[model samples]
Target: MNGLIGKKIGMTSIFDAAGRNVACTVVELGPCVVTQVKTEETDGYQALQIGFGEAKEKNTTQAQIGHFDKANTTPKKRVIEFRDFNAVEKAAGDTITVDEVFAEGDTINAIGLSKGKGFQGVVKRHGFAGVNDATHGQHNRQRAPGSIGAASYPARVFKGMRMAGRDGGRRVKVKNLKVIKVFAEKNLLLVRGAIPGHKGAYVILEK
Candidate 1:
């Protein structure tokens, strides 16, 4: 259940050994440092906390500095906990590269926040079909919900009714995405198909 935190470097098409055009999402992955190790006896769990992305030393607080000192690594912008230590046998200040986490054809789940679309209607958000009349006395209610409730039965609008409202901007997990390739030298991971979130957003890659 080990995972790595990385930034989405957008996506591109690349050819495999067979010369097939493979759709992929390029990610700038690890080189994340092992910050803290939780043990079974003390923390009641076995896990290693890794830090990624460097933050300016001037902006980092004293408490953060002390924490990084324990691992002998410079201040990081973000820190994520990964369960299980035996996966990499990582130590404090040790960098975890993409090669150590995933390989080609490895099945993984990419978790990230989807891009916000800002107040979308049900037709676009939840895929609800709208009124099919473009004419025939129809004016501007084409995108409106035709009916909401029963007349003399329920007498109230039912809960969980799909309506036009705020949309997107939520954590989405794309499961079973195959890892097409791994560029360890550039810390890049090319995954097949589209993933959630906008470019440069932080994404969690889990296997």
Candidate 2:
């Protein structure tokens, strides 16, 4: 699969040729530099490791700076590798622009870390139904998971129980999304429907 590294640049609605409104996510696509190329003879597989975004000189470590030097590019904020890329001929220090890989109405997939929701309850996270009474004897069982396990059979809470703790901040992939528009000059990619993570968050666009 061919992929590009981009930033989620919020969302907006636009009118299509059919005069219908379409919701789209605006992404700042890449002019990613191919930093390293892994060949089967050497690294055991063929892959293109690319780098994107700009990082401050002092913020990145010396080792990362040196890796960017191999590509003759500036310090990048993040580095990602794409396996078995054959969409376009690429090389080390070569720039892969977003326009070459994506087109309007093309089906693509997006991967990103979801926004953190802190600690969540079972009702919100696991979709459990709480107690349903206020007048009987229950005082506050609105958002509770009543019984976890049986008394004699199990004796203790079973493993893999649907209990809520920390939620979100996990990698999520949104698939089969249609590319609404591509602004090649601006390196902007607009896609239909909602994507993972928050605005300005780093996202991987795969086709």
Candidate 3:
């Protein structure tokens, strides 16, 4: 009962009880099916493997097909294992809805893959102010990452310097987002403020 698998369904603004307009991200919480249960004695840990979303049988591997078959469900596009889950009594193929886990005004954390911004310069990637502004005959120094290395001391750039390369497309967790509303019938959850990733991306909601 610590977390559930879900999808980011975009955003909407709602007026809260305080009459303030609060931005909320809409998430389609599970109706996740339990695919497997690992016990401490058997797997050295206790966890529940849950599956959500539909997957094509052709795209699903033979091994995965059999795994889903044992759960009596179709292949799932997303599978996540929740460790130390103990609040609910569930077996394989049991569907868990949003209302079963979350209530209004619950502060939770959301984990998702952030949108990728390919290789970039330090200014855009790390919010560096750049070398300097265009001044007395200064040319093309505004966006440059200047003075990366010392003249002679050390004779090499220090490792982990704030230089830019690839950016984004990584797992990001946004914490302390309060649950605004929950539509159990539609399996949707509304939380205050924005979360990571683009629309339709899978997100893990943790209590």
Candidate 4:
């Protein structure tokens, strides 16, 4: 397997062998169950549909319950399909753990939803300088996105202007994050640098 579904546990600093404090994010990786296996002839592509995290049977739909039952496992909260996983031979109802896929010193990518910052201005969202010193009779217009369009030739604002509306809460991927440590017993992965999303958010780790 080349990837696993995981959760962002939070961030912490750990001392490296060089005695330098390295900031890292803690992720709780999975013992994911293969719910479905797709082949080129069957689904027009080769992929594995894996399920992670626990879900109560009452909260799960009947179809999903049957799907999990087919895998001989309980309901899972997050299900993701990974293509081009040709490194190992796996079948439906197989379990893949994090330790079997990742190790320390390996580089991987993490994908998750970024934290939401609602209704922000260009100063915060687009990193505008914000009216320089806020002087020259500027009061509340410091954070305003000034002079968005021309008055004569181009009368309308352009479609792709960098003016802010909503910020974040979108899919973000952080690549080449070095794996600092992997605790197989606890199912924790310590990776250098930050990944997307808030605490307890689900993340996908790929190699």
RMSD per model, one decimal: 2.0, 1.6, 1.5, 1.6
Query: What's the residue-level lDDT of 152 in candidate 4?
Result: 86
Model 2 regions lying over 4 Å from their true place? 17-19, 133-135
Predicted model with the maximum TM-score: 3
lDDT of all predictions: 0.88, 0.91, 0.92, 0.91
Structural similarity to truth (TM-score) of each candidate: 0.90, 0.93, 0.94, 0.93
- Over 20-55, each residue of candidate 2 has an lDDT whose tens digit, in order, gives 998999999998989998999999999989888999
* 28-140 per-residue lDDT for model 4 (tens digits): 99988899998989899889899999999999999999988998889999999989786478888998888888999999999999999998989889899876656777777
Stronger candidate by lDDT (3 vs 4): 3
Q: What is the lDDT of candidate 4?
A: 0.91
Q: Which sections of candidate 1 miss by over 4 Å?
A: 16-20, 152-154
Per-residue alpha-carbon lDDT of candidate 3 for residues 1-207, written as tens digits (9 for 90 to 100): 478999999999998778999899999999999999989899999999999999999999999999999999999999999898875889998988999888998999999999999999999998988767688877888988778898787899999998979999999999999998999989999999999999999999988
Candidate 1 residue pairs in clash (backbone atoms < 3 Å): none
lDDT of 1 at 59: 98
Q: Please report how far candidate 1 places residue 14 from its true position, in Å.
A: 2.0
Error of 3 at 165 (Å): 1.8
Full candidate order by lDDT, most accurate first: 3, 2, 4, 1
lDDT for model 3, please: 0.92
Instruction: State, as a TM-score between 0 and 1, how close model 4 is to the true structure.
Output: 0.93
